[model samples]
Each structure stands twice: as structure tokens, then as C-alpha cells.
Target: MTDAVDRAPAHVAASAVLRVGGRELDLARRFAVMAIVNRTPDSFYDRGRTDALDAAVRAGAAAFEAGADLVDVGGVKFAPGPPVPVDEEIERVVPVVRELAPLGPVSVDTFHPEVAVAAIDAGASVVNDTTGIHDPRMADVVADSDAAIVVAHSLAAPRTQLPLPHYDDVVGEVAAFLRERVALAEEHGIPRERIVVDPGHDLNKNTLQTLELTRRLDELGDLGLPLLVALSNKDFVGESLGRDRDDRVAGSLAAAVYCALHGARIVRVHNVRESVDALRMVEAILGWRQPVRLRHNLRPEGNG
Candidate 1:
């Protein structure tokens, strides 16, 4: 029988690399972990734990030390609450980006063109636009810089309520949306190598719709770009397992591993160490990564 690793999708091949922030992320050789460094006071998961500048910097440094490949800094909460002005958003995230860029590649999670430009100027290497570049200026700014862009699919604008979000076919629609956005990004002068596509989970998508997208996520790889998935304690896991945000680590790890096996290149996660460990285990099993120590059954003396 053919080894399962041999059947891995084309997107996960060793030659596939994602360029961002003057670095080449070997997506196939080692799955990339983009740790969450939220600077938002009302973040759903941490709930203001990293809102303070010092706390945010410490959290990002610790995640990098714990094996995270990059840190994603975001000031405003993705959910609706209050409008954060462009200047306020810039103030919240740019400081954290300036500090964390020295540790590893920094990804600024924002759809605002001004915020993206500010973060990039502050040393951020990736602009993760969850609104899928609804404002075309976002694409323009990213194109002008040497940074990469994550084109995420979301039905509504940030901080807007979209009750009863509908999709005739969630996976197909998401794939189509990402494809179109990626084309637009390229048209805006952002090179194909500097682009990543995300099927934004739980963003204007109900639990059932999110679950369907997760199941058929591989279809998105047909777009032939690096796939970045933000599946860290999302509402889908919470609703599916009946667990709160704080209790969804195991479920999140399970979903992350499944996605990695199915060709997900990068996973943006809140629990960095756990997500890193889970992805490393999957990578080792698939022969993409080597075990740190392999002396378990190699002792000549036999079992003690």
C-alpha cells in the first residue's frame, strides 16, 4: 500500500514556501504557527489579558520562545461593539508590532488601510485582512510594501451585525471569494508569492456553515496559494463541543491537526505551545519533520 504521506496534497509539498517579512516560511517542511497577540481589551478569548502594551509584548515574546513561527498583532476586536478610529487602531497595534518584529515575523490583523500601513511601517510583515480587502486601499498599501497579505473571506464589514448569514455552498462560495480577492490583490501589485488565503471561520458564518467549510477546506487549495487558517477557539468549536472559549484547547488542536493533514499551511492560534506541539506531531508522523529524540526503541539493552 502507498504511504499516506505520499498521498499528501500538492500544496503541502516540500518546495512550497511562503514569503513574508524578508523570510521564507517552509510551509511543507515545517508547518508554520502564527501565535495570537491580541492588543484588544474586549477580545473574546483572552478578555483583556494582553490589552496592556507590556502584557502584549510579554505574551508575544513568550509565544516566540515557545516555538511560534510568527506573532499576529491585532488592536480591535473582530466582533461588533464600538467603532475604533483609524488613529486609535494604529496606536493600539503599531507599538506591539515594533516590539515583536525583532522576535519573529509580525502579522498585523486589520482590514483598515491606514492600520495596515502603520503596522507595516512599524515592522509588521504580513497584513491579515479579515474583511478580504473590502476597502481596496488595503491592497494598495500592502502592494507598496515588502509585506505579505492574508486575503480572508468574510461576508460583512468588521463591527457590523449580519444576522442569519447565508451561503448557498459555504466551501464553494468561500473558495470563489478568496480566488477573486487574490486576483484583485495581484492586480493591485501584490505578487502571488506574497499572498495567503483564509476561509474566515465564524466571521459572519454560523456554526453549521463554519463546520461545512472546515470539512471541505481542501478544495480551497485548488486556488494554488498558501492557505492560512484561523481556527483557534473559534465559535464553531465552542458550539460544536459545548465548551467555552477557555475550554476549547483540545477541540482546537484536533481541528488544527486535521487541517494540517489536509494541506493547511499556516494556523493562527491563541494557544501557541499546544498548537505547535500538535502540528509538529502531525508533521513528524507524515515524515515532514524529524523526531527530536528517537531512542525509544533503539536501545540495544531492550526494555527495562
Candidate 2:
């Protein structure tokens, strides 16, 4: 029997385009910056910075203005805590999704099928499931709508703490998990084009595993789906540089650039402007994107 990787086509087509809601994203021509807008008070990064409805909306709008290709509106903290009922989760996110949808393409970060349905009804174009579709019904909701789905590889359920997860070969295991989840999504009627895969850095793995996944991200490209990497202020980068959350911007950007070079098409980030700049630079270097202007150091003829 052929290995799954071996069976995958040698060269997947480039110039990929993904349509989400009314927006068209050229995955091959440019890297997408997905800004995180959290509505939970206990979120790992902001710690309730945008917990209020108005604040969340403003945050989403600001991210769009800062060159975010998409904004991920999340209501619940990923770490274990008090249970946030589905109704409350929907209450926290749907309003923000409704208000932000008109600004640009919006993605709702959720693992609940009910919340996914409500957000899609309120105008979200993508469902960012960090649980790797533990709730299989979420796939059905995504399938019934025109939204794209982000299938992240996490070893445990959402908000649940686990003993340090172990993997024999982190990259191979991640790729296999993603392939399985992607297949599950397709089985539920989500087209391959509308499915994105994420390796779930730091979600269930340690810093070393996260770094290994980053180093071997290209292995996931064989899945023939666009890759979305959530490396924004993650613990791996912070731990690697001995920096705290606030000081992890440089490290995060470095990791994001590395992922982009290794075939990640979308980077979910906190610092939208810096992430956009870094990604655009990488795209320019790879010849996928062009510089804004070329006259910086070129002297006019007969002037030099």
C-alpha cells in the first residue's frame, strides 16, 4: 500500500484562490494576515482587552485598517476554565461577527456547532475550529453554509488541560492528523478548496514540538490544502526567546516568516501591521508579490 504522502500528487497546482463570503483571496499571489479579536475576558493574550462588544467591534475594525486580510472573532478562551454556555458564546461572538462582516471577510473561532451556525448566519465566512473538529457536527454546519473551515490538529478537546502531549514524530503526526480531519471535512461536503489545515502549534504540544512543526511545515503542503498557522505570541516563540507575551512580537514575526517561506498561506496574528509587512516582504522575496515602489535606491539615469 502506498503511503498517504507518496500517493499525494508530486506537484500541487499554484495560484490558488479562495472565496470567502464576498471576498476573493489569492492564496498564491499573497499571504493572508488573520487578526485575532477575542471577546473573552480570560483570553491568553489580551486578557479581556476587547471583551466588551463595542471594544471587540473596534478591535476588528482596527485590525482590518491595519491590513488584516481577515479577522478571527473568538468568544471563548482556549485554555481550561469555567464552561461558557453555547448561548453565551453565540451572544459574545455573533454581534461582533455581524458588525465586522461588512468590513471584510470574517472568521469565527469556535468549536461549538451551534456557535458556528449562529456566526455563519450573522455573516462569518469561515469557521476556525481549534479542536480539530472534535465536534463533528461543526463540519455539518460548515458544509451547509458557504464558509470555509480551518481544521486545526489538537490532541485534546477545547478548554481542556492535558499532561504534556507526546508525539513520536511531531511533523508526521501533525500531517497525518490534518489529513484525517481534512478528509472528515470533505466527507461532510466541504470542498477541498474551502478547507484549510493548521498544525496547532502549542495547542497540545510543547515548545520543542511546536518548533519541529514549524521546521517541517512544508510536509503539510502535501495535503493539497492551504495552510493556516496560528503562531501569534504563542508560548513556543516566547519560550524560545525567553520573552514574555508582550515581547514576543519579534519572535512571532520570525516564526511567521519561516512558516511563510515553508508554504504557510495564512498566518493568524495579533500585530496586524507588522505581520503584514513581514509576510509581504517574504512574498516579495519569493516572487509571489511585488514591492510597492521600486525607486528607493535606483538613481535616475545621468544623475549618479
Candidate 3:
């Protein structure tokens, strides 16, 4: 197998730290988990379970208590659905941001400049623009605030479906797109430390493409920015295991671990507690974090 460093472009070097939401994550030493809290009624996973203001607030708090490093509140579903006016989007997300901000770092998953600005004003520290900050104004919003931006690679606008996304080399193409987006972000005043990149997972690709991308995820480190992989209960996981959305947790965790071991520094996930435990175990095994307890097999007195 080719080494991860060997796979990376020799001309580029990976980033060592990620700065976001007044927090600095040492990418080389630890991984952070960003919990998903959707305020949309038609979210593919939870399906309105958290659309209510109270429910959304509770969910975000619980996720943080469960060891999530950050909470991502998204007002609109990522899938192609009816258009949600900007005002409604703000109304749905801002209050949640206001409530969650005091607890921990909050990320607003949006592509609209207006929504991003509102969320930032409401105390969000990150703008997760799945459209790769296609709107220059979105970049301005992040630049104007102390928040960071998550630039994701997608072939089409949100709510628009690509018939069949194709790429001669998915990893290379995605890397190229992210490099351009990252450069655009810098051009708009966002610094490299405050910018993160996402591979967009099943955003525009099919199962095969997504799997291939996962296989070569380490190549993306060449971009030298913190990598965020959102692999929570995605279509690729379900399809790969011949399971449904509700049954993809195991596969999701597997893929997330694989990505983290490769190059992912942050994982955006729906199953916060499980993902947290899984990643913590990985961290401990890699010696980034010490084991919570070393009683097991230490001696006969402490042995189970």
C-alpha cells in the first residue's frame, strides 16, 4: 500500500492545526466531532425530530454533553426539496444558535449568504457551506466575523440533483475543486487556519464514487487545510451494506474511523455519542489520548 505521505502531492504539506469558534484543535494530536442538529422538518435522517425550537435546543445541548466538540445546526435539508425562504431559514436557525452558542462552539450549515450572516450574528462560530462557498458573499460573511468556514465540494447547487455525477479521477477532481475554493476563500479575506474542507460525500456522487473517494481520502491532505468528513448515515454507507438509513450506524462509524485515520480532522455526524466514543477509542489507541481507565488486565487484583 502507498503511504499517505507518498500519496500526497510532494509540493504541498498538510495543515497541523485547525482554528475555529475560539478553539484550536491540534489536528496532529486529536480529532473533533461536530454533532448534527437539523432544524428542518424534512431532514433525511431525523425527519423533523428536532424541528421544534425546544427539541432542537435540547438536541444540541445533549450532543455537547455527550462529548461532541461542536454542534452544527442546519435550517434547511441538504436534499432537493421545496425552497425555504431566507427569512424562514433564519427564523429556524438563529434562535437555536443563540441558545447553543453559550454552551459550546456552534456551526450553521448553510449556503445562503443571508443565512450565514444571521447565524454568525446569532453566535455561530462556523459556517458549513456545502456548496463550497459558491456565493462570494458567503465568504464575506465568514471574513467579516470571527467564525470559520467549512468549504464542501459539490457539483450542483443545494436542492438541485445531478443526474449522474462523473469524474475521471474523483479524488483529484475534488482536491482541485477544494484548492480553488480555499484560494477563493483566502482572496475574500478568510485565512487558511480558519478554513476547513469537506469531500461532500454523497453530495453529487454515487456509491462507487464515494467509496473510491474514501479509499483515497488521504490524498486530500495535500491541500494542507483541516479536513472535515461528514459521513453520518449517508446513502453510500446504507448502499454499501444493503441497509436502510436507520441501520447504517455501524457502517457509518467504520467509514468515519477510516477517514479519520487517513486525513480527517473533524467528523460531522448525527450519532454524536457513538461517534465520540469511536473516535476517542481511536485517539487512545494512537496515543493522542490516554485511556480513561487502565484497570483491565493490569494485575490479578484489578483484572476482570
Using TM-score, give the best candidate's number. 1
Q: On residues 191-262, what C-alpha lDDT tens digit does candidate 2 reach at each position?
A: 877888889989899999999999888888788778889999989999999999999999999999888778
Residue 28 CA displacement from its true place in model 1, Å: 2.2
lDDT, model 2, position 66: 93
lDDT of 2 at 282: 67
| Model 2 lowest lDDT segment of ten | 4-13
Tell me which of candidates 1 and 3 scores higher on lDDT.
Answer: 3
- Candidate 3: which stretches are off by over 4 Å? 1-13, 299-304
Better-scoring candidate (lDDT), 2 or 3: 3
Leading candidate by lDDT: 3
lDDT of 3 by residue, 1-304 (tens): 2343344323122667667767776766677999999998899899999999999999999999999999999999888878899999999999999999999999999999999988888899999999988788998889988899999999887789998898999999999999999999999999888999999999899999999999999888788888899989999999999999999999999998998888888999999999999999877766666788767756766445
Q: List the residue pairs that clash in candidate 2.
A: none
How do all models score by TM-score? 0.95, 0.93, 0.93
Each model's lDDT comes to: 0.89, 0.88, 0.89
lDDT of 1 by residue, 1-304 (tens): 1365685555553337778879988776678999998898899799999999999999999999999998999999899887989999899999999999988999999989999998999999999999999999999999999999999999887789899999999999998898899899999999888998889989899999999998888787788888888989998999999998789999999999888867788999999999999988877777766689867658655655
lDDT agreement of model 1 with the native: 0.89
The total of clashing pairs for model 1 equals 0
